[model samples]
Target: MKIGLIGSGDVGQALAHGFTSEGHDVKIGTRSPRENLVSYSDASSFGEIVVIATPWSGTKAAIDAAVAGNFKDKTVIDVTNPLVMRENGPPELALGHTDSGGEQVQRWLPGAHVIKAFNIVGNAFMYKPEFPHGPPTMFIAGNEGDAKVAVTRILTSFGWETIDIGGIEGARLLEPMCILWVLTGVRSGNWNQAFRMLRK
Candidate 1:
């Protein structure tokens, strides 16, 4: 499948390369295509699936740049964290409790199938994450069942086990795990670890 990535940052680039390595056609969208990325509008229309990997703060702008109607019924992946900078420290979720970035994306692209994933781990561990412990779990959610299934297959191809925690609102639960991930990194100076769920 052709995958269009809406952000050219670390997360976007990492996943683009990962998918390309797996023989999927990938295009990255950014302000600078001279830097080997495509313009946002092109990307939104370029792929079978589009991934929103822009930083939380830049999400709206990225979405606007992506040609509003181009996303209709397309599979849109949300890999962004709503991390708002806090004074004297790291960031916290800007939209949560009652709403989340994922929900906002759904609102922004009302016709798109917005599935959230890959927001819980560092980009370094996103693709083919192999730790001594075991395969990590990727939690995903979306209103579109077929879309989530496709994303689950993508996650598995990227070397992750997955848990579909239900509809888009499930992001309320999944996004917080990102906070814990960042806190663990800051506190331990280790950003290499990924989350895993064990069941007997």
Candidate 2:
């Protein structure tokens, strides 16, 4: 599988490395047209799976610049969160409590199948996560059932147990999981911790 990543930040880099290590062709997209864009555009033209890893603020522009129409009929993994922090304070979600970044991305790219995954967990534990017990659970949601299944397979390949939390509307719950994750990191200085869904 050829994967096109729209951001080169930590989350994007981690996922790109993970997929590349799993024998997928990976292209990291940037704002500047450079060494990778030619091949990246070719992959996009050929209908490769694209992952949007840009910051919440830049998500729309990134999708717009990447040509969302090119991603039509393609599965897009949305891993962005809309949290803006004040100086030395806790982060505030830019989108209202009812809305989420994933839904916004979905709205922007109306034709693309947008699945919300990897937003719930910290990037440190995103690829090849190792826990004291078994694989950590990852929560995913999207309107397209098939796309969610594909994303679940990818999550399993990356060493996570995936839990499908229903449609894109579930993103309202999943996106803020990042806030809990970051708060834990700040309070305890543990960046590697991940949430696991437990059942009796």
Per lDDT, the best of the predicted structures is 1
TM-score of each: 0.97, 0.93
Clashes per candidate (backbone, < 3 Å):
0, 0
Model 2 error, position 102 (Å): 1.0
Cα lDDT of candidate 1 equals 0.92
Runs with alpha carbons beyond 4 Å of true place in candidate 2: 35-47
Weakest lDDT window of 10 consecutive positions for candidate 2: 38-47
Residue 1, model 2: Cα distance from true site in angstroms:
0.9
- For residues 81-140, what per-residue lDDT tens digits would candidate 1 score against the true structure? 998888877788897888988999999999999999999999998999998887899999
In order, candidate lDDTs are: 0.92, 0.83
Worst 10 residues of 1 by lDDT: 29-38
Per-residue lDDT of 110-134 in model 2, one digit per residue for the tens?
Answer: 9989999998787878999999989
lDDT, candidate 1, residue 98?
Answer: 88
